[model samples]
Target chain A: MDPLFEKGMTELNRPPTDRPFQAFEIVFWHVLDEMFEERLLPGDVLYETALSQELGLSRTPVREALSRLVAEGLLENPAGTRGYRVPDLSADDLQQVFQAREILESSAAALAAEHARKGDIGELEEIHRREILFSSQENRREYCRANVEFHFAVMRIGGNRYLERAFRPVFWRSQLYVNYLAEFHPLNGEELTAESGHNSPAEHAALIRAIARRAPKAAAKAAAEHLRSTTAYRILLDTERARHIFGGSSR
Target chain B: MDPLFEKGMTELNRPPTDRPFQAFEIVFWHVLDEMFEERLLPGDVLYETALSQELGLSRTPVREALSRLVAEGLLENPAGTRGYRVPDLSADDLQQVFQAREILESSAAALAAEHARKGDIGELEEIHRREILFSSQENRREYCRANVEFHFAVMRIGGNRYLERAFRPVFWRSQLYVNYLAEFHPLNGEELTAESGHNSPAEHAALIRAIARRAPKAAAKAAAEHLRSTTAYRILLDTERARHIFGGSSR
Candidate 1:
């Protein structure tokens, strides 16, 4: 029989422990929660020994878990080293990731429009509706979670397993930047207003409409531009934060 | 002291391994080679125990390596108990990857045009020149190798590691399909003729010119269109091949 857990698709009835997934998978997610949840930052070192001791697990599983994070591009392990850490991206790196995400995500959205089932469109409408709900209430965390799901939902509809699988890791790996940016970018009406003044929820609404109508070209354009707006503002935020935190001389 | 390598940079000397790299890393690449060079299908089983004995290593590294591949989307490990296998793509899955690549690569090319440095442009031109040599000489392997490098040359000049890193694995991963297509595509003059009908050489030259001129929009358009052309053509070829190999009933 095929293994239960495919990527991002939850496994409700999976056995407690299995060959491919070690206990470290669970333990690793807990540690990753600190990073993906934004309680950690790049440049933070992960002491394998310490984590192994704390979790009461062997070094092997801890090591394996860390390897998974490194593969996800969230952590960097150099030269078969004992300790691992996150990569601290500069403005250049941020631009790079955002630009890539913008283009790739847009393309995914467009393709999704071509193959989208009625149910797929319905799911996206629901996600967008809930996004608006979370946005008005200013629930940043919930907004972040929903935002990821919405994008992934688009990927799911796009019918490209290869692309979906590749892109999702990138999405997870980028949590640091995404989470940090979200701190200043709240989900409230005022925050959305200031942010969306450039493109606003209207752009996303347009995207949803395009998908609903199954217009590939329009959907693609909407998605790409939406991503571009977010990245462009992300660069500005990074610049402003750097100046505020590190001073002009540092920059 | 970074053990990880980067593109187009001269390597600082380090002691070579007495054996190969880690067993799992070696096996991962070996399997990836099948994806790239040998046409390992999407759902092909990659067994740890068998490969471990072959490599004269324990299953530990092999298992860890499989996890890394799973994260990369090349191999999927089902959630519960089972061995790891490279997952097959539905037509939708393949479409998503190329679509994403099309957008990102196009944008990168456009950006390369706008921001590519003189030296970087020179380097890309150099790579293109090599492609001419490989193409005319009828060395299929060399031509394909040169082709990948030439595209990478654009990415390098684009100066976005994040974009390059994200685009390449997914792009190369499609070699799984290309490898099969090449079986029918053959290295004959007909194949070469089909390939050469496009002024890719001229497009490369034009892209370099745009980069030198720092025309970002032009570069982006050229790059995006270039990818779309390739993706569309490849899909056509895939359809034709499926019809031929599996009979018309397959489609």
Candidate 2:
């Protein structure tokens, strides 16, 4: 077993006091987090029996959740096979995912600017503050979670449930990219932390300000720019890594 | 026993020389069409065994397809039960669905404007011309199908597979609204036909022109306006129906 999987298992073992999600949902998201963090790499076999036993869950819900992931195209459903494998994320797939964010998140921000109440705006500010604090502490996971929370808050502020639902799978898959950076990139953990520490907070603050001012076009532009910045950073890192490997020009 | 279900059955019964979709996929989309057309309204039970028997398919594939739809939130899985139910589309649900269209389709149009090839432009023109011809013939179904095809063609032209995938379920659900107008609205078929004949072709022509000119902003704006126009028409019909029901001044 990979050490990353062991760390995930340890985290899963620590019971949450609140426990809002169902058993199946808990395992479902845990496995997804593993995949996002690159703890579960492409072609990593997910054994149903081991996962169920380890999570203290029954086999049925575990199978059900895996089936859902398989349908979402994140995991491959090998015919007549008992286990699932993580599907490889190609460059084209990553590009399309971010392109979708440019469209969906920009629209979401514009709607948020138009429709967000004072309370909604306050919630975004609160999340931004939490993100800032987390960045200072170098708590990557909590910072990432706070970022997701801020985006979802904006999704609700948009006042469109269908937009929320339609954009959701795309958003979760995009989160994988952030986790990919935090875990798999050639940069050390400290460098990764320092990179997000320097970049994410300012972008988030600008996003909140745009929403607060009710500037729909500005909000939309801010949201798209924020996503593009992350993509740009990741691509730059990938290019650097490639240059290091192949002895070629950075471009 | 419903007439709409019978029509869906006939369509599904026809043997195909070039069957591109799997049996499960065929059944999944067929059921969606039935739901959108109101052949399977709220509270209608979807029995896997009966569906399998009627469609000349096995239980396993039908079950798998229903599971997929259930995940998509079109079907409510009854606890401790074998079948599914169609959920009612609330007014809020309808509003959100169209709002999603405004975001997604606009983004798709912008991308299409940026990336569309000459062949893509020609294909869109071909669809537009066909739509014009269909409007003159007052063939509602063909016209609606062609409009869907045109939009999907633009999605393909956008060159973002994830965007295409994200837009798909929403697009399918949006088609439900068009079919809802045909089936359940107060207007007769002739009136609906007349309405689309007057409105849709002009909007579609404008959209084609924007894309052909490679004007991303114009294309996005046009696509969003076209969707809002449809929503406006539907809301007008709904208001009229409400007035007829409650004996009050139309709000």
Candidate 3:
């Protein structure tokens, strides 16, 4: 049985958005949103027929959406099956992802510092402002969206198109996994609750200031630290989850 | 007409390898080998029927091989055509590729330093020795094959599957372009002819020593320097090529 359409999940039945997107685009974002919200956990099958019927659309769009998601690495087709499911990555896999991100994003930030024009800096500032704005809202999804935009703005400002393109899929897939983790196990729950929207903006401000000063090394360090801190929180969350599962004897 | 099959290329008509392999594998490697040797330059067309007929095989295997190459970013289907062509990337695009490679490969070397066992170091040494041996040989293709093996051994020793997977396509595509460039313009013609394979092995040895000592920072630094030096040579070659093309007025 599909976990998404399983019993007691009545809230997800809302009609697909009537926005001016093509049907495939609509379905793609809907599935992605569900994955972000952890409504679709690892092993939750995305059956095209079920999704199309639930969303009041034909199967073609849903199928195309699944294919795109699979290509994006957010979902995978199980062996001998047509349906897609959230990919299951091991701890080593997750660590490699973070390690790669640290290398790429830090370089990107440094390059951004070296190359960012006034317009680029201004754009990043605007994105950070929106990120801060969304963080205070009750909608976590909106905050996530703004966060993605902010980081991508930095990547674009870095002025390395190949780096940006290569980084995009990894960043998105990592976020999908990280967001799913954060759903139940808040990484640093107390700090998250206490700071709410404050710390991220402050961090972004520091990064922006470094870039504004054209201090390449400092900007790279700042970006790397930002990502490292996030990963640190994730590690803490993983530890906490394991402790719970093992009756506090693990670790 | 397929550039590979056109005029004066009688050497390619030799029977596909006698080694026990399927048809598709032979076609794939043949195309890849041609790309590595710069026999298929940028803008060279790869007509499926032509390649299939020339190789004395059906089009299905050739088509699959082309698709894989396209996925690997070696070939692209030109607009309004069924044939593929070597992609034409700008100077900026090539620079970005090298930048991304520097980030990924350097970090990979660092990780390998941290995690490489004695056995891993031994394997790398063996691969490096093979590279040295091939360097003395007149066959540039054999030297390249050994070079690829040596680098991939380091990636494997790094013990990061995600990084290795992400690095593979980028590395291959960059090699394709670099090899093409080197055909007409040796990156460092004088030094290359003077030292031949001697200098590269020494560089590899230094990297191996760092990893053997478990000096992650030193290993990463060495790896990055190696790539940076290679890129420096490439820049020189590009400048020389430009000077010739523009009657020495472009600079």
| Best TM-score among the predictions, by candidate number | 2
Please give the TM-score for the first chain of candidate 2.
Answer: 0.78
TM-score for model 2? 0.81
Model 1 alpha-carbon miss at residue B221, Å = 4.4
User: Using DockQ as the measure, which candidate wins?
Assistant: 2
Per-prediction DockQ comes to 0.46, 0.48, 0.27
lDDT of 3 by residue, A1-46 (tens): 2343332212222224444456766687778667655567766677
Order of models, best DockQ first? 2, 1, 3
State the lDDT of candidate 3 residue by residue for B1-251, as single tens digits: 23443322222323344445456656777787676655677767789899999889998678667765664566887434668977774565567777777777888899999999989988988888787777767555555556667777788898876677567767777776565444444444654431233466777888999999999999988887777566333554466563432211111
A153-234, model 1: which lDDT tens digit per residue? 8877877665665666566655556555444343423433323333435677898888888898999899877776663344
Q: Over the stretch A201-238, how does candidate 2's per-residue lDDT look in tens digits?
A: 79978988998999999999998888777833465447
Off by over 4 Å in 3: A1-34, A45-72, A75-85, A186-198, A235-251, B1-34, B45-72, B75-85, B186-198, B235-238, B243-251
Best to worst by lDDT, what's the order? Answer: 2, 3, 1
Q: Each prediction's interface RMSD?
A: 3.4, 3.2, 5.3
lDDT of 2 by residue, B82-119 (tens): 67876555555666777787778888899899998899
Q: Return the clash pairs for model 2, or none.
A: none
